[model samples]
Structure formats: C-alpha cells, structure tokens
Target: MLVALRKIIRHFKGDEDGVALVEVAMVTPFVLLLAAGVFEFSNMLNTRMLLDAGVKDAARYMARCSSDWDTCSGYAKNLAVNGAISGGSARVTGWTTGEVTVSKSLSTPAIDSGTGTELYLSSTANVDVVQVSTSYPYAGVGFWSYLGFGQISLSVFHQERVLGW
Candidate 1:
C-alpha cells in the first residue's frame, strides 16, 4: 500500500496537463481588467468629443443670432442637452436644462475667466460675445466602478462673437 501511494504521488507531481489551465487562470483576471479599462476610457473620450462638438455648434448658432436672445437661448439649450439642432438627439443620458448655460455680455473678461477657456471666443472690435456651456457626469462602467473609482465630471464651453443680424 505504501509503494502504491508513493507511485500515485510521483505521478501527480510529474503531470503537466494542467499547466496551461493554471497559466490561463492566472492571466485571465488581468486581461479582463485591461479590456474593461480600455472600453471605459474609450466611452468617456467619445462622450467628451461629442460634448465639445455640440457646444461649439451651439455657441456658433447663438453667436449668429445674439440679437434674438430668446431664440438663441432655446437653440443653445436644445443643442447642449440633445447634441442636435432639434430635440431628441441626446447622445449622453441624464442631461438636464440646468446643465446647459447660455449667456451674453459685452465684456470679454467674463467669457475668458470661465470654465472651458480653451474654446473662448476671439475678441473682435465692438462685437458682443455669446458663451454656451454644458456639463456631464461620467460614471465609470464595468471594472472601473468596481475598483472604487467615482464618477468624473466633464464640461465643455464655447464662445463666439455675435454677428449682427
């Protein structure tokens, strides 16, 4: 019985059939985490780009119609929330009117000293400025959320000189 037990132990120790399975098991978690990170990052980046494009379009539209405050406000609000000229084109979820801000002023300083300064309007001689801004909360998906990383706040702002109607 002792000799049989020793032979069984030696056979089990020399077996290589489970090596691939062990390696895969060890690497699977890291691969899954990497894939999840890439997916979440890509989604966040796409959302930001969409917000930027929408904000710029909204700003330009408002600037062209600065004289009509009501129209500009409505158009900007719709564009910010929906990412389209008309309604019902919202690319990101959980957007609200409060997240979109539209304002006009003669002073360029106000526009310069606001969030999203990278898209600030160029100063023109005697032209009014219109600024449009939108904010979004990006909650990480998949493994990101599971790792205790919280939501990220993103915003886009664009300013353009009002073209007299």
Candidate 2:
C-alpha cells in the first residue's frame, strides 16, 4: 500500500495534465481585473450621457418658466436619483435675463416698425460630484496620499432661451 501511494504521489508530481489549469489560475486574476475595468468605464460613460440629457431637460423646463431655481434644483436632484444624472447635490447658477432686439414685424407693411423686444432668460444647474472623501472608504494606510486618492468634482450646465408667454 505504501509503495502504491508513493507511486501515485510521484505520478502526480510528474504529471502535466493540469498545466493549462495552472496557467489559467495565474492569468485569471488579471483577466478579471481588466473586465471589471471595462465595466467601470462603461458605467462612467453612461453616467456622463445621463448627466447631459438631464441638464438639457432641466434647461427646457427652465425656459418655459414652469420651473424656478428651487424647481430646477429639485428636478436635477431627482434626475440624479433616477440615473438621469450623477453626483450628489445640485445648485442653481448663472441665472440671467436678456432682451432680444429685432426689426420688422407682421404689423409693418412696407415700413419699418422699429425694433421688437423679446425676453431671453436662462439658468444653470450644478451638481456636486461624489467626492472620494464620501465615496471611497479610506484605509488606515498612508499609501492613499501617495496614490492621490482624493477629492474629485464634476458638474453639468444647462441653458435655454425663454419664450414669451
């Protein structure tokens, strides 16, 4: 029995049947990391697209005056929650109004009716990006500083021309 067991052990030691499996085990971790990176990249890209669309939608809402700073902010916030946009918080900024000047109108018949006035208004929403301080749980290692795992910020801008009501 001892002789048979020693033979079996020697056979396994010299066997190359599982060489491919050994190689696979060596490479599997790298392959999995690459796949995970690709998935993360796709997610980031999708988030960016959603952010753009949300900004444009909020801009349209603002143009109609159906939404104000608070409403726009709320809409942006909801969008973030709904995956229409990403980040943490939304803020209203770059709110402005301008007057449009144009000459000639339907009322003018072969005559100059002077300049026509129209109101132009726009607003922007800013979203606070997920900060590393909030998102990434820091380990007790000082290597985080060397790795530059720190603050990150991102925001979106939206603008639209207001239509005269």
Error of 1 at 50 (Å): 1.6
lDDT string for model 2 (44-110, tens) is 4555455555455544544443435454445444543342334434322211111101111122222
Candidate no. 1 TM-score = 0.75
lDDT of each candidate versus the true structure: 0.76, 0.41
Runs in model 1 deviating more than 4 A are: 1-14, 109-126, 140-142
Stretches of candidate 2 exceeding 4 Å from the true structure: 1-15, 66-151
Backbone clash pairs for candidate 2 read none
RMSD of each: 4.8, 14.2
The candidate maximizing TM-score is 1
